[model samples]
Target: MTTESSCPRCGAALDEGANFCGHCGLALVAHPSPFPPGVSSLALRERIAELTAERTNTDEVLSPLWALLPLIAVVFGTFIGILLIFTPSVEISLLIFMVGSIVALALLIILNYKLVDRYNKHLVREASLRRTMIEYTWTRGQERGTTDAIYPYVSALESIDRQALMDEQPRSPLWSLAFLIPIVGVVLYFYMLYFLTRFASVHDDRWHAFAYNIHLSSMVNGDMVPPPLPKYPQERSFILYLLLTIIFSPFLFYWYFKLVDDPNKHFQEMGAFEDGFLTATGRALTGL
Candidate 1:
């Protein structure tokens, strides 16, 4: 039952102890290894574990600091907002309020930009790593000369790049200017909140969503830059102002947290899921 082995490069019998095909002079040792058809379960599990560990390590290094940033902005903004509310004259109050608001807004904008930048960079790194892993797996599989057992993990890296580009740019001035209308302003504020949350979800960066919500809340409350004072002194009654903020502040904070934590949740349902996946992930990664 002896069968002759033919040279891969030329149809000639391979002789015993021959390093090359006698007829074609092609090296026999240059042939690829005939390994198993597919990746072993043990090796697959090991790779999964390694990837998970790397993700965990990266989260540990980045999450806590990011989570604390929004909280800090809220506390500082609240203190300044209260102080501006108590200032004696409308002019003085407006001046102090504008100063505080500008500082808070700038802080929020800078922090948000930095966070988004870092997130995009992380995505690029992950995409590159995944590509290399896929190529290596493919090469190994090809060498074994099996066509049936391909496990492709190729991701659309271009989609990640496009999303990152969309996130970095500011909304058009036409849209931002629409915030000047009283009724339209409220609508635009909520719209922006929705946009940021959706953006964060696509990037898998929930902390950015939460932070943007808080920042938007601060912006809407006029904590970033105060609005102009009422022309009439009677319209600036302290009692009326206090009543407005007290009645509206809690509800506003509630909505902001709802959008950031779980955009699907209503105001009342928000508290129930405050400590859910997004919050836990943010806390775990940022050490917040």
Candidate 2:
């Protein structure tokens, strides 16, 4: 049951199990399709249509208000401290204030950690989706004779370290232990800002380059390609944030708010790209 074979690119005759086309010199790499066995592109088309039919952005919508949670503990401690002024037992009041502040701070830290962890997980899922979409398109391009125009896209997609994108594994409970010691907790708190700055800088550059190359390839290949992922602008200056924190400690809450709000905004922007991608993918599958 040998079916006739030919070059997908130049339409030249191909011998049995030929790996490369003799006429066009296109590399005939066999990429595994994401589609299930016996399923045609028609199924993919339906899926894409379904995706476009509704908002496909799945990133969790986190409110910036949650970032103000730490302030609740601050206000509570402040109220307790005011009691020291009128209390007959100064030592007892001091003990209660110190113990209460420590407990409140620890609880706030744990709660905020959970919020950040959830956000990072959402980002990881989004990264996986982006990888899947790019790989699917690359495979389809090979089948549809558009591999030459998509090579730059393939290169760009491959340049991104998948592990780095998925490295947002939820923090261990032991991480909160850093808050047990006053000096250590302060150091770790500042370190988090440093880490955030680095994270933003690295990912911003990487994704910007990836989106640029992906869109370049898409434009060159016309409607046959799926639309590129929209780039999210996420460059933040650590020095600026640090200075603001020094001037007014309350600004740290705003920084936390930015952490939640930025990704939500990114998710909103992605809705448009997702719709565009689904429409383009449907057209490509239909053409096939």
Candidate 3:
């Protein structure tokens, strides 16, 4: 959605509701509201409530599977020990222990991956709803029913976030095989950790969440000018949360999903989405 700004191709004002510049014929982004723009506050509340419910249901289905992680690790570990002891080559029990644990962990990952894939469509829709609402907030205005106040910073911020979600999608634990080699594996593991925290930190700052102490500034790794409305919480040391996630993933998992479904809470409270994107092009400079 663009405001009636001069076209980049040919400094011409676009006609109201027209997606292309009248004089230049350059195509503009035209985002129609997924939910009708004008209605009673009650209508907005109703749609918001529905989205919240959908996210809640996805969480419900995921809860028990997560709860089973510890049990699965323990049972699988113990069963491998006993079975290996009875083998003709009992001397290789130690090797079996390491291999067994990795295999067992991989099985759990596959199970969760299937579950996540099942609900992914819903997550995408939820993300789209969040994006649409944020975009709509910037565009909606009285003169032409929408504003053309589009800025490069806004576009860059949104692109980073949307791509971040897709990048954070559940990949097969087999990818951890990169860890088998010495130096390469170490690099891959840290790279994976960086990706995980980067996405998590963005959500934490964006939604004004308190569930985790993620380091937003460092993790974003982009130039940031503090946007006014987001009022981001002070970020923590990157090493701290990354260590916490590695050592105690169950709690982090809960917080991760909690942050995922939190857009509704902010949307409900703020009424209109104020751009929370931290960009160097914004007011105050940080990490430019």
> Considering every candidate listed, which one attains the maximal TM-score?
2
lDDT of 1 by residue, 195-234 (tens): 5445333433422333233223223322221222111111
**Residue pairs with backbone atoms closer than 3 Å in model 3 (clashes):** 2-148, 3-147, 3-148, 139-147, 225-279
Model 2 TM-score on a 0 to 1 scale: 0.69
Which lDDT tens digits does candidate 2 get at residues 121-170? 54555565556556555656655667766775776676664645655444
Backbone clashes for every candidate come to 8, 0, 5
Question: What is the C-alpha RMSD, rounded to one decimal, of candidate 1?
Answer: 19.2
TM-score of 1: 0.37
Alpha-carbon local distance difference test for all models: 0.42, 0.62, 0.45
Q: What is the lDDT of residue 219 in candidate 3?
A: 20
Find the 10 residues in a row with the least total lDDT in model 3. 210-219
**What lDDT is reached at residue 85 by model 2?**
72
Off by over 4 Å in 3: 1-61, 64-71, 87-103, 111-123, 138-140, 143-190, 209-238, 241-288
TM-score of each prediction: 0.37, 0.69, 0.40
Mark the regions of model 2 whose C-alpha exceeds 4 Å error after superposition. Answer: 1-58, 89-99, 162-177, 197-205, 219-234, 286-288
Over 69-143, each residue of candidate 3 has an lDDT whose tens digit, in order, gives: 545766788899888878777568778887888977675455444444433444454464455433433332211
